[model samples]
Target: MSFKYRFAYYLVGFVLGSFFVAAVLTGKDTRCNYFPNARVLNDLRNKPFEYSKEASTVLAENWIDTTDIKNTLTYGDVDFDKSNIKFENGKIYIVEGKTVKNQAIELKVINYTSKAVLKEIKKK
Candidate 1:
């Protein structure tokens, strides 16, 4: 009933509640992608990716295989400044990401109602 006992009880309860919440959500797909790069990567990973004609051509020109392209898409960075504004022309998002063996690459992803298209690949 004393001040010290009340404080102790509150601290214990808070710690236990936090642990319970963490445990309950341990199996959930909870990701904290707050930065622009992380957010773009998350968007790409969560949605289905389609390649545009131009982008495909670029890939072929560079002899970049599908697996390498996939790796780039999966682990690319977003040059937010270089990227176009999203939804400016119907969900057009230009995300810049680097590949394992390459640098200064970008993907112009046009997100449609049901899918996202990699419209262009550029070497910057």
Candidate 2:
């Protein structure tokens, strides 16, 4: 077979394989949450969240709101070194991100079975 013919066959196979994979994964939430940070953040995002008194107070004082908190959780970096993953009640995760106004913020969240509790919030 000529080089051109072989190249055409390979290109066709690649395109077909790509299409097959895309069709199989279309309309599906096939997100890869394999890493600890991604898995923890995804788990926390899925569950409903409650704010503690301290957290709420910080939010109000800093001109931040629940929306900002939610955004931070959705796009924050978890500080595993400062988090207590083996707490007796539940795992506590410290997530650091910025507010909508570009103000830096940090959130301490405790993950429970049913819901997550925003234990603390601070402007950083």
Candidate 3:
């Protein structure tokens, strides 16, 4: 085939292939979390989340509700340096994120799991 014809054919095929891939993956839960922090946070979010009395009390005192904590976990930055895994109770992670209102906050989530708890969230 002529060069012009070949280029046109290649361009059309490329566009069609791109469209097919997008269409097939539309609305699918496709995510690529390559960073260590992102992978950790994503894994945590996928698991069940729970809270403790002390965590609730601290959250309430700091004007942070359950919803805020959920938002933070869903869209937060995990500070590995601030996380203390050698706690007597459970492993703790310091998660930082902004609220829906754009207010910045820090959270200390204790991963003390039982038959009921997955993660305990508190204000950092």
Top-scoring candidate (lDDT): 2
Residue 91 of candidate 3: its Cα lDDT? 70
* Candidate 3 lDDT for residue 100: 64
Highest TM-score against the true fold, candidate: 2
Evaluated against the true structure, the overall lDDT of model 3 is 0.70
Candidate 1 lDDT tens digits, 84-122: 566644466666656656666767777665677888877
Mark the 10 consecutive residues where model 3 has the least summed lDDT: 114-123
lDDT of 2 by residue, 1-124 (tens): 9999999999999999999999999969899888888888888999987889988777777479788888888889999899868666789999999888999989989998889999988889
| lDDT score for residue 63 of model 1 | 49
- What is the alpha-carbon lDDT of model 1 when measured against the actual structure? 0.73
Query: Using Cα atoms with residue i matched to residue i, what is each candidate's TM-score against the true structure?
Result: 0.67, 0.82, 0.70
Let me know the TM-score candidate 2 reaches against the reference structure: 0.82
In candidate 3 the C-alpha lDDT for residue 102 amounts to: 69
Q: Residue 41's C-alpha lDDT in candidate 1?
A: 67
Clash pairs for candidate 3: none
**What local lDDT score does residue 18 receive in model 3, on the 0 to 100 scale?**
97
